[model samples]
Target chain A: MQYLNNIGTYFLMIIELFRKPTKWSVMRHLILKDIDDLIIGSLGIVSFIAFFVGGVVTIQTALNIDNPLIPKTLVGFATRQSILLEFAPTFMSIIMAGKVGSFITSSIGTMRVTEQIDALEVMGINSLNYLVFPKLVAMAFYPFVISIAMFLGIIGGLTACVYGGYSSVDDFITGIQQDFQPFHIVYAFIKTFLFAFVLATIPSYHGYYMKGGALEVGEASTTSFVWTSVTIILLNYLATQLLLS
Target chain B: MIEVKNLHKSFGDAHILKGISNTFEQGKTNLIIGQSGSGKSVFLKCLLGLYDYEEGSIEYNGEVFANLSEDKKRDMRAKIGMVFQGSALFDSLTIEENVMFPLRMFTKLKKDEMRERASIVLKRVNLEDAHKKMPSEASGGMQKRVAIARAIVNNPKYLFCDEPNSGLDPKTAIVIDNLIHEITEEYNITTVINTHDMNSVMEIGDSIMFLKDGLKAWEGSKKTIFKTDNKIVTDFVYSSNLFKKVREAVLKEQG
Candidate 1:
């Protein structure tokens, strides 16, 4: 019954989304804002994670390859698969949810508890459409851009591996070229899009329903971040099974 | 032009509003006065359809609000403008953008046209030069004026102000009160202000409804309010030292 009620609420929200044209405009503003935040806010972290993880993975994989019969090229294939299929979508979302999702939830939830949402309602504007829709669009689009960032980070790590005498640049490129399938990239993109939606929607919903006062808003933000990160991980596993299978 | 009949609202076991029924007339400043927990804000929210009342009917110009479809309710909402307590201005948008928000959302007005309408309303609230500034940059009183401008930019038929003068200096509070009153008269809008300010009651409360613990204790115009012998009403009105002194002076003259 509770699950049914949640579905019903989501359906109502979607219907409300279509009813207002301003929601689209608001969504545009939110998406642009998210893009800006992702660039300025998430860039350093993504680069740090990507560069270090890339270097560590390549080094560890190189050390583990003791069998002279096993091709040294297999290390690059393994790293490529890990970065594209798992690391970019899963770890990046965790980081983004902690940083971006928390900010979105707290800011919007504070507005909700403060009667700002009611103010919009009284002005003949739909607060959900104005507030949530923009966030939805932003989260949906920005992750795809971040995936590209993650891809570059992987390349940077591979370059470091070559400098460290772990693998030749030609061998690394050859391993990725031979093993990297279009479907892996597509799956990564799809997962990131879904992850973004969950991140934005869950937090916005929590914030939109926030009541009481500052304490409640704080609790909502914390809950949104925790739930969204968990949801993203769970969904990533499910998508991998469903799509990769 | 708004009538709330037998309104009752409860949060789980605790009842907030107990059968509140009142008529807010057109082209008049109707005030709801109460202490902090008297449920005045809840009553206003109930009227706006923000709070789902367990039982009651709100009729706006004879249209039942609860029975109306979402679209119809939205149409009614568009016709109503509200100035929220704490200003409630959008932090992300500039003052001009905040004022233009409803115009852009509700109407298909061109950008230039929306700007024109926003400017007119901003000037009406005496905020002609603060358009580019964000809500965070504005003073508390200035923010309240911007909120008023945003509320009235749509030229709504019904104006709802939830403690419009809250958190402002006395002079600024009067300015806001008189601005609401003047707008109510000029637009012939049905203006409902929720306040506990005694000075506001005297200045522009053409009609006043006093709520005590979620029940309507008294309903009368400002003129009759002074003559009321109701102890609760007197206690509230004369609670201020200035008003207490004035009341004593008047009684001495009579004696």
Candidate 2:
């Protein structure tokens, strides 16, 4: 029942978010600011995690397939498949639910605790539209972050395969190309886009409606992170069932 | 002028405002004073349309707020400006940017024109020299001044200030009080202040409403509050010995 309530409130918030829009001139600045905060600010952590996770995938695949009958190039295939299908999109998004999600929650929650949101509402500004819409628009570019992740992941896998004696550079490169399906990349990005919207809005819901003061802001951020990660996982499962299965 | 008639508000099982009815005159600093949990903030928020009322009407220049369409309500809200207790300045913006925000959002003025208008208000609040600083860098008094500058930058018809002097020194509090008074008179804006600052009450509270436990305990001017025998209003106002002596001296002067 609580889950149902949350889902209902989340949808209602989305409805309110699109109404009474801020002026485009104002929205443009807000979107730019959010892009800077949510996207540009997230690049370093995404890159670090992607590279290391991709390397681990390559090493794990190579060690598990010790049989000579299995082609060494399968290491690269497994690495690319795992990175694109799961690591880059789903797993990295879980990280974002912590990084970007907490950011949105804490900032907006602080604003609420401080009466900044009230000031906006009293000024006739739609605080929801003013605070959340820009994030939704900015998250439309979530693919850019995933694109970086995909690039770094593949590079890290290639480096790992060559240096770790898992496979020769040529075989790994060949494996990456052998059955390269563009649609899988599309599938990954479709999930990325969906999760991006999830990441932007769920935390906003927790923060915007949060009550109490400074301590409550911390609690709200934690709750937002937990809920965002949980929702992303659920949506990932649902999307994969529909898109992949 | 703003008027509230038989106002009542509640949250779940808790009633916060009980039948509050009063008029806050234009061109004057109208104050609502009460101890914590006395519903002054709730009353002010109801007037601002930040909170919905269970029963009653809040009117601005005779336009019934509850009956207005969303568009109409928004239009009414645009005519209002508010100073939050914490000043509520946008953390990301410099003082100048904070003051220019409403103009940037609501008007189509050119960049230079917006800057010029922001400068004019900033100067009005005596914040010209602190324009480039962030809200965090400014003193509490300066932040309050910046808030005032932002609130009036759009030339609102009604100004709502929630404890504008909450964190200021007594001297600075009086300065802020006087500033609001001057602005209210100059713009003919109906200014409503929610505060428990006795200094403010005695200084610029042209009209004062005292609340006790969600009910209107007393309503009178600064002069009448001194002459009245209402213990609820007097006890809260004179709780401190210094203020008690001040009130006794005032009554003696009156006698």
Could you say which candidate leads in TM-score? 2
lDDT of the structure predicted as candidate 1: 0.83
Q: Per-residue CA lDDT of candidate 1, range A1-245, in tens?
A: 97577657766776675455564555577667866774456777777787778777777778888899987677677778777777787877888788888888888888887778888777556677777776666565666556665676578658767988877887787777774579888898889888878777777777777678999988988888888888898999899899988
Per the 3 Å backbone cut-off, how many clashing residue pairs does candidate 1 have? 1
Candidate 1 lDDT tens digits, B1-255: 999999999998999999999999999999999888999999999988888999889999999999998788888888888888988898889999999988877787888999999999999999999989999999999999998898888889899999888788999999999899999999999999999788899889999999999999999987777678999999888888998787666666766
Please list the C-alpha lDDT of all candidates, in the order they appear.
0.83, 0.91
TM-score for each model: 0.92, 0.97
In terms of docking quality, model 1 is medium
Enumerate residue pairs that collide in model 2: none
Tens-digit lDDT string for candidate 2 (A1-245): 98798789889999999999999988899999999999999999999988988898898898899789999889888888998998999999999999999999999999999889988998888899999999999999999999999889989999988999888999999888878899998899999999999999999999999999999999999999998898889999998999988
Task: Give each candidate's interface RMSD in Å.
Answer: 1.8, 0.9
Pull out the clashing pairs in model 1.
Answer: A27-A134
For model 1 chain B, where is the 10-residue window of minimal lDDT? B246-255
- For all candidates, the clash counts are 1, 0
Chain B alone, TM-score, model 1: 0.96
